[model samples]
Target: MSLLKVRDLSIHFQSRQGILEAVRGISFDLERGQTLGVVGESGCGKSITNLAIMGLLSDNGQVHASEVTFEGLDLLKLREKQWQKIRGKEMAMIFQDPMSALNPSFTVGYQLEETLKIHEPQLTKVDREVRCLELLKQVGIPAPESRLSSYAHELSGGMSQRVMIAMAIACKPKLLIADEPTTALDVTIQDQILRLLKELQDAYNMAMIFVTHDLGVVAKVSDNIQVMYAGEIVESAPTRELIERPQHPYTRGLLRSLPGAKETAFRAPLTSIPGIVPALNARPLGCQFHPRCDFASEKCQHQPILTELRDEASTHLLRCHHPQEEVL
Candidate 1:
């Protein structure tokens, strides 16, 4: 059985103007011991999608799905009490900004133990402390013992992220959701954190959903990649395949903005996809990405549903009216 399966999952926010469909019908599966990167521009609903899966979306948001199953249980149907047992135990999320994600007043140790206290209540106080120390060490935080007593304010941004990672993995969750885990850190620290997460995933045989805006970071860690746009998945394939042979114009546009394409040797100006993502409540009549697409035509005004193509090693999915015949 797949470790996680999500099908036709959609989210909408109720507002005075109208309902804003933040996530359109989308689906994917995650196998055990694999990394799936969700990459998109800011405000493209990458974080909100995971938030819905984790049952963290605000009350104003409405989620509906044919199936959002994790280990055979439909997450869409789970209540808060049931989710309490799953969140932080079977699954955990590492937020983008650790300093804001963590509690300001609590010591790091207390926050770390809360995961165990809720899920592994049988563990004794000393055992919890021992496990917490091990987790800190596992994430490569120096002076683990001393740092346990420190507050979030005391640690640097990178250190705070390590603490967050430790807390997320304390229970050895089967699934890990990392939402821009290295967002604010320096380049050196960013590389270290990515390396650490990759090591941890391999050691634990964990399935991870890594969300980020940078293709560079996704390249470093993901085995598979999903490119999202305007609350929908525009392209998905094995990382190498997607990089070597992107089928969607949007995916091609994103790749064009990457660092290597900007070099003088390429000599070509780095071109970005024109226009902004459409507003959710005011979505375009056809393809949501039509206004910004280089190859859009009158037919593109009607949204093209996701279509799957089988490749030698993996399936590639794309949502586009003109995947093969774009003049540009």
Candidate 2:
């Protein structure tokens, strides 16, 4: 059985402007030790989808799904108390900004130990301290013992992120949800974090749902990639396959917009999509991406359902009236 399964999951929020659909019906499955990358522009619902799965959505947010299961447990059906027991132990998340995620008042050691205190209560104080040191060391923090006493503000961006990783994985979770975890770091630091995550995932044999706007980052770590537009998945396929043969117009646009995506001159202009993602309350009627899609047609006025490609063996799925046939 799959480690995680989400079927027709939708998330909505009640607002003064009325209901705002943040995530439309979307479904996907993740197997043990597999990495699924959810890629899209900001406000495309990538983060919100995972937040709903983790049961961290606000009270005003309503999640409706035919099925949202993790290890055979119905995630949508789980109450807050039930979710607390599973979070951090069975599943954990690395937020986009480590600085905000970590409390400023507490030392790094205290935060790490608190996670263990709640999840692994059997461990004695000394054991917890040992484990905290081990975690800092595992994440490649220099002088693990000394760093323990340092507060969040004392650490560099990379170090703070490393600390966040340590806490998220302290309990050896079976699944990890990384929401733009490397967005705030420098390019070099981002590379280091990505490599570290890959190593840890391999070591723990954990499944991961990596959410990011960078296609390049996703290409490196994901086994499968899902391209989401405004609140909906536009395309999905094996990482290499999708990267090389993107079918949806939005998917192709994203690739073309990447720096050095094409073999153009050194200083040539980078391609960019024309418009921004629509506001939740002002979204267009049919295909949400149609407004920005260069190849949009009259047929695009009607929404397209996610459908598998013609090849019987291929797992490529697309939701487009005019799927691109050319390679990127």
Candidate 3:
């Protein structure tokens, strides 16, 4: 059975200006031991979608869905108190920035212990300490015992992230939501962390929802990919197929804009999609991505629902009026 199932999920915020639909009816599923990567630009609702799934969106945010189930349980109907029990024990999240996510005052050990105490309160103090040390070592932190006493600021960026991973997996969660866990790190560190997470996922047989704006990072880790643009999934396919045969104009634009093999800035001109993602209040009528889409025609003046790629496997889906033309 799928570990996670989110169908027709949408998220909106009550703002002073007006209601802003940050995430519009985007849905996907993750099987046990599988990773689904959500790739999009900043503000494209990737994080918002996952936040809604975790029941962590802010007070002003509201969620609506036909169904949001985890292992056959209806997650959308869960109360905050009930969600508390499920959060770390059944599903855990690793925030984008460990420095900000970890408390400044508490030692790393204390934070790790908090998760353990809440979920596995049966663990005695000494047992908790032993498990905590093992978690640190599992995430590749050397001298794990000494590091447990260290504060968040005392550890380097990479080390802090490792600590965060350790905390997320402390309960051996069935599902993990890692929201750009590799952000702000150098390329070398980023690679190491991705591989580490993959290793851990295999060892635990955990399903992961990996969120990021970087396509290269997504390509490296994801089994399947969902391409988001303007708050909706524009395209989705198995990883290899998505990379090799992207259908939507928005998806193509994103791939073309990625840095080439050099991985350095500028020699040839960089390709970028024109027009920024529309603000929630200013979202275009008809197709949300129409204004920025190169193949947009009068047909695009009407909205299109997500549909299977023409003549392709049923699993490959896109939301576009025309899928045959090359994306500008």
Please give the CA lDDT of all the candidate structures: 0.90, 0.94, 0.89
Tens digit of per-residue lDDT, candidate 3, span 172-260:
99999999999878899998899999999999999999999888899999999999987899899999988878888888877778777
Could you give candidate 1's per-residue lDDT for residues 36-61 as a string of tens digits? 99999887889999999899999999
Tens digits of per-residue lDDT, candidate 2, 140-187, equal 999999999999999999999999999999999999999999999999
Give the Å error, residue 1, model 3: 2.5
Candidates ranked by TM-score = 2, 1, 3
Provide the global lDDT of candidate 3 against the true structure.
Answer: 0.89
- Overlapping backbone residue pairs in candidate 2 total 0
Q: Which portions of model 3 show Cα errors greater than 4 Å?
A: 261-266, 325-328
TM-score-better candidate, 2 vs 3: 2
Cα deviation at 146, candidate 2, in Å, is 1.2
- Cα-lDDT of candidate 2: 0.94
**Considering every candidate listed, which one attains the maximal lDDT?**
2
Q: Output the lDDT of residue 101, model 1.
A: 88
